[model samples]
Target: MALTAFVCGCTGNDRSQPQAVVILGAASTKDLLSDIAEAASNSLDRPVEIEISTGPSHALAQQILSGAPADLYVSANRQWAEAVVDADLAEPAVDWLSNALVVVVPADPTVAVDRLEDLASESVKRVAIAGENVPAGIYAQQALSYYQLWEPLSASGKIIRGHDVRSTLAYAERGEVDAAIVYATDARLTDGVRVIARLDPASHSPIVYSLVRLHGESPAADAVYQFFVGDEARHIAERYGFQAFSVSQDEE
Candidate 1:
């Protein structure tokens, strides 16, 4: 229950309680970050209590900039990391993982959609996507724009914008929307949603996850960051459908 409690992106943790490390992560990294946090604690000689906040990368960066107490920050894309660094809220960032975008629909034979462009069809009464500034949403817009579908789709008023990728995925999972654009890893994790199409990697900016330490740091927090970028966490991330930062960086 404690671990589950700490996984939320909102500010619900009791501030008075002593915690070893406080990490602010993007929504897509919730499960992966929690797994790494537990594994990193087990590897340490002493137990370290890790608390994580998960949400849109842009929103998380804004929280850190507005003076939220955080030891480590993991963003879903480099632009948000760059924004934090520009504000001098964090140190230089390092790429941690890579992911691809995909279009998802409920696992129903009734849906005849098969490609990203198909989302513009009249049959798709509703489509879920992250809000304008969220990393996943921005990427989704880029890909849709490349296919020249964004403007018309926006005008049609069928777009259902969510605060983050998870929320967007939730809409698809609950059948609130006919389709949603989210990370491939997110689509993989949810059972009710099935990926209908994979967006071409070249269609948009690279979806690189990055980490940065806050202005004030603690040894325990630094240790957790080190463990996160180390081989152990990298292996865990790969198992969860994330790609190596190095492999994707070269392509970028």
Candidate 2:
């Protein structure tokens, strides 16, 4: 997917100086982070302009490694988050959110894929999934492999790769593909698609949305990061179908 950026809380009047906090988030968290940014801007005392850029988790991580300006990094998986931490670009990442994978088909009842195994059937022609480098695709592949369906599906040339989870879901939403594997949260975003099956959590690695506080000393950035881990943020995430990870649980 194209790297997209948005600036929130900006004013029409040219400000001589404004505190800005930059956030790099995974594509799946795009809407969620946007909501959080608005809320954070409202709750903060000062004029804080929040900038958000989103794409596939791996791509975002590479940007961070390449000196992209980011005060906070929210990854869809631990691997990329830890890569940043390992590179000393940020502090150790904290698992902040979680999501589940699901098989979705067009809302049209005629396009049905009721089970994981059904993906291999001729009836389900094209299946859309993110590239393997993306977290959503990685999780989908793991789940499919656990059920012994990856090889068969790959060999049949039925798998279509999307740049990110949102794009993957779009393929099913637009009826360009018979089915798609995406996050439950993404599936909820559109009425054009219906979830046929949720991949079992045990079938793949834990879907942890890890957060990193990039090395920076801006109070605005600190405030934004704190707000993200606060109670209100957790509520916002839950509304988006994301399970908030308790900091205490991580400590334990």
How many clashes (backbone N, Cα, C below 3 Å) per candidate? Answer: 1, 0
| Alpha carbon deviation, residue 194, candidate 1 (Å) | 1.3
Q: Report the lDDT of model 2 for residue 228.
A: 90
TM-score per model over all chains: 0.89, 0.93
Q: Model 2, which residues run further than 4 Å from truth?
A: 1-16, 248-252
What is residue 230's positional error in candidate 1, in angstroms?
Answer: 0.3
Q: Per-residue alpha-carbon lDDT of model 2 for 69-135, expressed as tens digits?
A: 8899999999999999999888778989999999999887455688777899988779899999999
lDDT of 2: 0.88
lDDT of 1 by residue, 18-73 (tens): 34688888999899999988788767544468887788888888888888888888
**Could you tell me the lDDT of residue 242 within candidate 2?**
93
State in Å the error of residue 191, model 2: 0.5
